[model samples]
Target: MPNHVAVNPRDHKDLRILEERSEGMGDATMCCITFPEEFRNLQNHYTILFQLDQEREAFNCLAMFGLENGENLFLDNGRWDASYVPLAMDIQPFMIGRPSDHDADRKVVIDSDSPRIGKGEGRRIFDDNGIPTAYLESISNKLSHLDGGYRASSEYIDCLKKYDLLEPLSIDVTMKDGAKNRLVGFHVIHEERLNKLSAEGLAELQSKGYLMPSYMALASLSNLSKLIARKEAAAINV
Candidate 1:
């Protein structure tokens, strides 16, 4: 099944209209990550996750507000038996962010079991430099009392704030009870100045079918990046 069909065949013109009328953010591309068990058959951009969920789909969605085709897709699949959607790009920079031995002290705990976390085994830790990372058993004894996953470390969040990039934006989960939950997970730390794009930047982005973007989406990725970097640094230094 196709992901999105224009209500009007002439809506193809709307793509140009959308390109020109896109506000807030200059031009955003769709970042769709699918879980093999869910969206193994679907492959289309601009589809709604909830609708996809209703259609028995399983995929994560992100509006990559500012990106060029050649950029890396940095992501971590913390769960087992999970397949990450490939961005059809080079794998040089794409890595599974994990924890480290130095973080043998850091832990991730959840309060409720009703949510039924699947990948509750260990933590992926990053090194100080934020490049290479490792994984270890979560050490926090207090985590059994919290709901959802534990909030990422403050160190991770602060660094993400510094880079000023877009985040995973949203999470769409279809529970066992057939209910879909859209958790606005990450904070949108920055919003684009749509009315303020420089003529040159806009022209360049437009010509290349890319936009440098004014706003950035943020999530726990910064911490994951931090943990990876920290672990790599620790390993190298050791």
Candidate 2:
């Protein structure tokens, strides 16, 4: 299903260009809908409609489809507007749910054939296989209240340094969004000691986008911070 083209029957009639009815609104218009690479993995086709006002106001209408069997699938309305990064944060339900005292052994599995997570839900489930074969109604019900966002602060870095798990890396910042003053920095790990880094060490790196494992693999050897310091010292003739 590389490219799909659909015709709108309502707008198929040809009107004379000289007529007043055709003067304001053009008769034939074609819309090319392109999907970003990230969304290619989505199994089902989705349609989104967006409306914007003069004051930069925006609203969205999600298309809800009703199948002959009375099943429903809500298509994302933002598909035509901006690219989105799909995010899935691991959940621990005990903390968020009351009591926070569920035994570690208690766990639940959601299968695609399960009625609660019907066939056409919003959050689809993919087997370790190449294709997504299941759908889940909600991740919230299965979630345990384990708060999991742990960013590596400077103190955490100090601890990692004590274990020799962290070393100084290069910094390269990209300024792409001037309006937001957003800066993306890269901290490259040296190839010699990278294999020694463990899952816990990688978790610390995950706190900063720049420290992603792929960046470690492709980062330059030269340390930008050290180079700046050396340049300053030489300028002062120290």
Candidate 3:
């Protein structure tokens, strides 16, 4: 469990965050939650898909990084190979929080238990004057965007559901070494249904700026082949 506390410059003056990409910092994952706002950039490097969120009882978008559990092909050594890291992945050990449900204002919160939390050899969150540093400012921006994107995701999912645009996706990969892997329990945009959508529906989606993201999700499937290629290369090196 995460020990989250509201960020305060006075209390966390000496706090710093290690920004390196590695499994120890929790980067070893198959996928990360993504948002439509980032689909354009993510489509270029990741296979964007949707999965059923039983808790939310709705679909959640994802940016796939590997074929199986605890495998992030994008994390090469200490670097992330992708050009655009999902906000969910980039904003580590920090999150947006509300004081209470009645309170509409949001504030920054930090995970005190995260491996990234450190006092030495990392980026400082606050400077000598107890003011937020440039890195902290960037993190705040990412958190804000992530918060907004999370809220907007519901509306996007509703639109796709209304249009009956989601379809189950199952991928089977056979590596050169005769090992097999299967990716299941995910969904993708039904291109056929999207193509058959009524003109009124199309206009409505366009007006709400949901059409491009729908297309972006469809385009992202192209990267699945690239991901598989990377997996094969990793196997060869191993």
What clash count goes with each model? 26, 10, 0
> RMSD to native for every prediction?
23.4, 21.2, 1.1
Instruction: Please give the ranking of all candidate structures by TM-score, highest first, separated by commas.
Output: 3, 2, 1
lDDT of 3 by residue, 89-134 (tens): 9998899887767557788999899999876879998999999999
Pick by lDDT: 2 or 3, better one: 3
Which ten residues in a row are the worst by lDDT in model 3? Answer: 97-106
* lDDT by residue for model 1 (126-219), tens: 3344322322112121122111111221222333234442333564544344544454533333335333556764565445432321211222
Candidate 2 structure quality by residue, lDDT tens digits, 1-238:
1121111122211211111111121211111111112122221322211112236332211111211122222212212112321111112111132234666442323221222222333333343432322322133332322122111223433433444543333334332332121111112224445456677766665564324422322331222333233334433552
Which regions of candidate 2 are displaced past 4 Å? 1-99, 102-133, 137-165, 168-188, 195-238
Q: Could you tell me the TM-score of candidate 1?
A: 0.19
Q: Which residue pairs collide in model 2, if any?
A: 92-144, 92-145, 92-146, 93-143, 93-144, 93-145, 94-144, 94-145, 95-145, 96-145
True-structure Cα RMSD, model 3 = 1.1
Please identify which of the two predictions, 1 or 2, would achieve the higher lDDT against the true structure: 1
